[model samples]
Structures are given as structure tokens and as C-alpha cells.
Target: MAHGEGSHNRNSVEAGLEARGAELTGRLIKVVLDGEALHRLSALQEADRTQAVADLEAENEFSPLSHPELESVLHLSIQEGRMVFDIRDSHETPLMAIVLAMGPFKMLIKDYQMLLDSYAGAIAEGREAKIQAIDMGRRGLHNEGAELMQARLEGKVMIDFPTARRLFTLVCALHQKL
Candidate 1:
């Protein structure tokens, strides 16, 4: 019984160490949105642009446990009307780079923008019903964008729904800059 207990304890310690190693390697340490890609966002109305910047800087946790190859720093940019994801390790060595065509996202983004404009107008006009309806549409479009992003990234990277939503926001911010 004593020998069996010793073996079990050793196995537990080994498992703990493996888990810790995975945690350490499968975390995103930083995320950078390219300055050139952010130009469109800067063109937004002052208040809207400020809010967009704040949203980008908000705390975000990224876990690539499902795709261990992606456990690293991430940089986002837009090139030739496409969203580019450049992933790098802690040492700044490039891991993988993926470019997603912006075409598929155009309609959803446009709809979201329209909804935002409508919602703002409704707010200014003091129409609660219109605001609520527009808000619902905005959320629905946002979710759709996130789902499309997740689908586009399938097999390349794994991200949670909230992460996908935030990524969609970033994409919209970049689109605004354009």
C-alpha cells in the first residue's frame, strides 16, 4: 500500500508540473494593433474614436490551449483590405501569420455601423423604442461578425466567443479608420 501511494503521489506531481507548463506557454502576453491599420479609427468622430481606443486597451485574456502553436504575442494589422494576424513567440520569433479577406465581413460591419448611427440618432431624438430596436440589431450584427470570424479562424486558432466579439470590434475599428 505504501509503495502504491508513493507512485500515485509522484504521478500527481508530474501532472501538476505539466499543467503549469501548458499554462505558461499557452497565454497571450501582448496584443498590438498596427498604427497604420488604426488610421481609419482615428478618423472617427472624436468621442467615438476615443471610445474605440479605450476598448482596444481594455484588459483581455487570450488562451491558445487548443492551438498550442499560437501561445505567444499577437499583432493585428490590415493590408490590401484584409485583416492580418501575425503571431510571435516571447522571443519575438514569428510563429504563424494569417490573413483573412475583409470581403466576407463587409456586410456585417456595415450593418453594425448603420445600427450604431440609428441608435445614436434615436437617442438624440429621445425615441426609446427606436433605440431599443436599433440596439438589438447592433448586438445581432456584432454576434454575427464574431461568429464569422471564429469560422474563418477555424483550424488556424481557437478563441472564445467573447474574444471573437472583441476581435470583431477591433476589425470594425480598423474599418472605420479606412
Candidate 2:
């Protein structure tokens, strides 16, 4: 988990979220994920505070999680060694649970952790140059993950790239916890 220096990094990550959350935007009103599944995946869960901020950012999509009486929730979980996306509507109706094999993202998850570690180290050592480089890698990896997620959810859930990116970030958060 990120401590002192890491705190700054974490806040910057969600800084844009608070700024954007003031408005009623985006499709989902909330996203839910439990710790049981996360614990089952790994004993390396990040601090709850960091996890909450990540979840909040992902759910809010940097914008407020407000919309019409349309679909508004996605329940993320893991079952039978696979990832489950249990999406629900405003009335809490079952939309779809896009189940995906965890294998495909295995490498990405590993890379994500590496980047997080590298970022933390860079921050700790005050290596601004390294941090910038790591940030670029983070963005590229995020885009790649988003594209993969979109392809996997094809014909199932129709969401924009940014939404998919947020969802993928959510997935990364889950990976940290996932």
C-alpha cells in the first residue's frame, strides 16, 4: 500500500475524479465489488482507502454517476476462476453479467503491479523523470486493456471507449484487489 509519498500519487490519480463528479454525467450510478473474491485472488490487496478511491473514480467515471432511469450498476465478482461483470439497471434489474476468463488478463495484471511498484519507487526516490515514463506506460497499458475489454464485451454491453477505459481501470483495481 502507498504511504506518505504514495498518498500524493493516489490523490493525483483521483483528483480529476472529484473535479468531474460535480455534474450528473455517465451511465453508472455505482459499482460494487466484494473483498472475499479479492482475498481469494491474492493476499496483496492495496490499502482500503486507495481501493475506495479507485472504485469511486471508476464508478463515477471522473463524472458523476448520474443518469436517467437506465442501467446504473455493475456488480463485479469472480467465480470459478473467471471474472464476472454483473451489470444492473436503475431499477436493479439484471442487465448482463459478462463473464470472462481471467487468463487473458494475467499478463496485464502482472504488468500493472510492476508499474505500480515502479511508480511507488519513483515517487519514493523523487525520480520525476521515471515517474513521467511510468505514467506513459500506464496510459498505454490502460488503452490496451480497454481495447481488450471492449472486444471481449462486444455484442454484450455497448459502452464507449472512455467508459471501457474506466471499466478496465476498475478491473485493474479489482486485480489489485481482483
Candidate 3:
């Protein structure tokens, strides 16, 4: 059955192409915040702020499956009181750009700053119980922020909880710059 054999071969080729396409579109290879945004992050106190930025840079990854057309590299910035996401392909081609309002994130960022200050004070004074309590509150706020981000990006992009959290931190850092 030569015709049957040819059909099977075509099907296999199409499947292979689909798989490759999926692999390419599934994940972000890297993410970078704009320089001015990073300068804002630098304004944060020396130790913990630096560590948080490092953690975000090293560990954060995004899966933009909701918008399969998005590229592998992403550039983030804050402009005119809005968060800007520039999605780029592997060859540095611009794909999609999204801007989200910053109003919803304001209170969360303020709470995060307060928690950071309290945590630092507790650490300085060697208050273990207070440190744990403050840390719990900090995490709660962080989680809430992440959830809000996910909700905001609901139809625009697909990101996991951890990615949302790291992005939230970056957004807060950008707010300080503004």
C-alpha cells in the first residue's frame, strides 16, 4: 500500500514540526528589566534588595502559552505609571508589547515596603518571634500581589505563581524609581 505509506510519512513530518513549534513557543529563555528600572532597584537598601534582585534574575522563568506568539526574551519597564512588557523573539524581533496599569499594585507595594522595613528592624534587634511574624506577613502580601498580577495578565499572558511573584517584586522596584 504505497499510498498508505506516504500518508503515514506526511503525518509524521507534520507531527515533528508541531512539536518543534511548541517547544519554541512554550517558554521564555531570558528576562531583563530596563536599566532605569534597575537603577530604581539599586536605591533599595544594600543587602536584602540586592539579594532579591539576584534571586529574581537567576530563577525567574515565564511560560507565555496564553500568547503563543510571544518571543523567548522579555524586556520589562515602567513608563508613565504603567508597566511595559516588550516580548522579543530569539533573533531579537519584536513580537508583542503589553502595558498594564499600576494603580492596583500601589497598595501592595506599600505594604511590601513596610514589611521589609519591619523585617530589617527585627533582624537588627534580634527579635526572632517578630522576624517570623513579619516574614509571614511579607509572604502573604507577596502572594497577594502575585495573584493580582496573574489576574491582571489573565488574557494577555500566561505565567506561573513564582514568575508572577518575581515580576511583582520587579514592578515594586520600578515604582520606587518613578
Q: What is the TM-score of each candidate against the true structure?
A: 0.69, 0.66, 0.73
Instruction: Point out the worst 10-residue segment of candidate 3 by lDDT.
Output: 1-10
lDDT of 3 by residue, 1-178 (tens): 1112333433454465467674313456666667464553433333444555566556654545444544477788888888898888777788778899988888898888777778878888999999999989977887888888877775566565676777787777667632
State which candidate, 1 or 3, has the greater lDDT. Answer: 3
Give the Cα-based TM-score of candidate 2 against the true structure. 0.66
**Candidate 3: pairs in clash:** none
Per-residue alpha-carbon lDDT of candidate 2 for residues 1-178, written as tens digits (9 for 90 to 100): 1113233533553464457653224366667774454553322324532454465545543221232224367677666767787777767788656689988777876797688778888888999999999989987877777667666654444444566666666566566533
Candidate topping TM-score: 3
lDDT of 2 at 13: 35
Best-matching candidate per lDDT: 3
The residue-level lDDT of candidate 3 at 152 comes to 76
Scored by lDDT, model 2 comes in at 0.60
